[model samples]
Target: MPPLNSTNNTESENVYNCPPIKHVPFPRSTSYYLQSEITDEFLQFAFSFLAASFQFLHLYRTVWWLPDTHMHQTVNFHLIDKSVALFLLILLSRRFWYSICITCVDLMVTKKRLYRMRLVLRYVFFFVITILLGICCVDIYFKHNNRVVYMCYPIIVYVIIFHFNIEPFLRTVYEGDMIYINGSPLHCCSTNPSAIRTEIDSLKKDFNNRFKQVIFTTLFNAYYGSVIPCFFVQNFVFYDIWITTFHMAFVLVGGFTTSTMFCLPANYCDVMHRAALHLGGWTRIDHRVASPATPWSKTTVWPNGSVVKYSGDFYRSHGLTTTAIPSNSYDNKFYMFFQNPAHIYTILSLIQVVIIVTQLFVLYFATEWHQMLSLGFLVLCNYFTLFKMIRDFFLTQRIYESESNIYARNLSN
Candidate 1:
């Protein structure tokens, strides 16, 4: 807007191809790097689909073809494995070509093209999985018996032995963990109560000085989001709390979008930040938290799939990270705001949270056993909400830093 030469040097250098935070480190497994060959949506989905198919394929062979063959390796299953591997190889090749396309083309060209390709791929796989899950969900989708507990397809999608066949595939492409709402989770996880409590009372306070908070933000969300629903199902006794809360689709697209009321400021300090200086102030902030230092600075090895290279500086104008270098964000945005899904998830979550919270309170007086259930659910719910809030707040901080980078580039030119 200015002469395009206006820049913020200090923030600029830190944003582009920047070093990892010396203090805070997050899970390398979750984020998608724009520059990484494997991180491309096509490549990722290819692998996920293949992985999913391989799972059920082998399962088919073992259960149907070689049920009683107690051997280390069997011809039937191996054949199935080989077939899947071949398919995987082909798909990977397809993605490899696409990744190359992203590498050489201008971002404007690349993004436009790649975005379409990704949408096509997203729907294709989602449809396939949905078809397979629809059968199971139909069997389970039921009304709550005046009891606050309930289950949905998203919850059961990855919940069984059959889940083994789907989970790896689902988890591989799922980067939606960090972007949770105050009530409903954007993504899903499998956890229990004891696990739920871990993130709540101890996390923020313990993580006050560590930006590792971001890394573990999803961890806590998963830990508790999953755990809370689990407690609801188990009645909170010495019961086995099998959890499958989070709405994967929401996670895939977007769950809920709380008001910018709690958005954090761009700078890392103990003061309230502007809800959004860029997005027409639809968001706002009052309290401020210090920039938790990035943890996981140890020189640790990462999965081959996690290594992504993006010149974050290039995307500064779009309000993305430049100083942070590209890392994993369990919060996947590609499938959400950019696509047709938009913020339907935000509205869904708000509705879900209100409904669930009220129903939960009503259940409080319904039965004492459920009262125990409510206690557990309460702990898990609050904890996950906190985790989601933390994720959203810090994510905004990142956006601001990225904006700063773009602001600098505009100035220099």
Candidate 2:
């Protein structure tokens, strides 16, 4: 047939490489923030690689309800798979923990004039602490197979929530670029700052206006939405995460970790909203006094008052950066609260502790819903923890690595 011959000719030409047209995919318009640099994507990839490897050396000896029954329907005793999984668990968990400490240190240290030796020492301090944690977990005093149910059962539940339920919900819901909650992938799309800011802001607005519309979307179809029926009712997975991670079946691990993770988003929302209110002038006037400023930060000199904070440079450039763009002073001001990051962080963290305490009772009494709830909770907790880890990394870059062109130009002189 003519069609078959034509197709064959095209294939032959492509195979022979007679200058066939390349089928390179065009980048999306929204990906404007992703410049020619491969650096950011590589760093994110490193973050994800570490996350996936978190399971390494994950051994806990605990008392078991049943001496030899499997909680996850099946158990893989294969040495290779076991080893890989364990490594992944540990590495991913470690990255999450490190993200917190690193963020704080970077923010604090970068603000001051510093030497290379101190910066290098700070990095060494981080690794030394991590190694100590690893050593403690390896001892036999902690490893009691008698309580494996107490150990593996809850962990299994957590993994289910992440890999099976909570993560899938986020991926299906957040369009364009998402890498679940715990892991990063090869595509550099997810961390392009401008795209992320736009997408997340849009989602939050959508959430604020019409979260109930969750039912009509394809994520909540007749079949898969049944996997999480609570979405049909509340139209969100956030509640499910809250209800599940507080299980008594996992008082020590689930209770502590779940509450910690849950606070991350709630805490972020509170902090950002507080800063937004100040920038938007919601605290002063009844009407929204509009301004062309980002929600997270803004700086306004009193129209008549002197901004006596800096020297001649502040007055010279008409309040713009040496790059001739608007100065990021507002952004810097918002983060200045990092000396504390606001009271709501403490409040949410404390409330998270209370919820875990309540969960202890729920575990002892609520038997029927235990497995499902615990599993769902575990997923939510890990997802939140993963999210917090990413935020921690990004915030550090914003505060520390962002070029202070003012400082740089002066330094060169």
Candidate 3:
């Protein structure tokens, strides 16, 4: 089959007529469109549970069983804690990195001299931070308690704060520009075929670049966050070895889910959907056109084929001139459950709640004030995550339900 970039109308017609890509069949009850997402969500939940359990076990053993002097002599808990915190911040700030890169690209194209200076300064800053973090890890490995290593702690904290604050400004600046993958620039109704093809290709490249960056960074963080911290513990006994092994194992699983099953499929779908919108909706393109871009190991074609459904209001909001694609009548329970952002957030909220409760229970039994403080920090982090999940859940549910009601009313009319 010709690639999606084919410009000739006859060639496009031939592409559309090609048979749908075949795949191994799934159970009839499950919608193929949702299979990967649903599976990924469940795997994410399992990974979260395992990681939280292992973290609690680690905290308990270190605080209650190990002799205080031996613990202090054998490991620098302060260094390990800070290093782990930095890694966690890195993992959580993937979107921030994505936005920054896009902003840099925009600056390069629109303001060349400014972009050059910003790029050089940013690289230098990143290099310095990386070296400092590396020095901290080296100190941890050799069990040295250098005061200078503490510097990275505050720097990482500042970066995380800056990420949260700057991301909104970046989004506002590039709200409807095609320079970023998420940008929703509306096309004229009579857009040229070549321009549409070019835009699709550009978007695909952006998605690929963003996806690779996420995978690389997640793996990097997993190494620092999960593996390096284990080195701080002496691992002298069977219990120590077991704890270290399980903790590392759980983190590896979590990293895999985060990189492949969770982020990959979701990002792939969103980019493809956005591409479909650019082409004036799913009806204009052949399903086969998107098959090549999907993460084939995790996804399959919908048995009855899938559709992109949005209302005219969605188009207007995005400043699109194209007509809205109608909803499919065959949308199944699995499709609804997986596609609804609220449902995903609800699952995350439940997981966060369980983790918080577990941490609090462990904290109650702790004798050491330092251990209590450590547990308190973890509890606070989980609480924050839970709050975001709950807020998103309600907001998404309201929007989606309102859209559904509007669609229903329009159908009845």
Best by lDDT: 3
Cα displacement (Å) at residue 34, model 2: 17
TM-score winner between 1 and 2, please give it. Answer: 2
Order the numbered candidates by TM-score, best leading.
3, 2, 1
Model number with the top TM-score: 3
lDDT of 2 by residue, 262-348 (tens): 222332333333222212111111123322222221122111111222321222111111111124454333323322333434444
- Assess each prediction's global lDDT (C-alpha) against the native: 0.30, 0.31, 0.41
> Which ranges in model 3 have alpha carbons more than 4 Å from their true place?
1-112, 126-177, 180-219, 232-339, 357-371, 411-413
Clashes of 1: 25
State the TM-score for model 1. 0.23
Clash pairs, candidate 3, are none
TM-score of each: 0.23, 0.24, 0.43
**Stretches of candidate 2 above 4 Å error?**
1-344, 364-413
Q: Judged by TM-score relative to the true structure, which candidate is superior, 2 or 3?
A: 3
Clashes of 2: 28
Tens digit per residue, CA lDDT, model 3, 1-413: 12222233453453353322221122223222333323433433343433433443454344334555456332234433554445444433433454455556655665647657655645654565467557656654455456335334434543443343332222211232354332323322223434545555555454444455445444443454445444443344223444445445435533543443334333233334334433332232344443332211101111122332234211111112121222322222212333344566666667666666766776787765545654565565456445645655665566556644653454344
lDDT of 2 at 267: 29
- The alpha-carbon deviation from the true structure for residue 340 of candidate 3, after best TM-score superposition, in angstroms, is 3.8
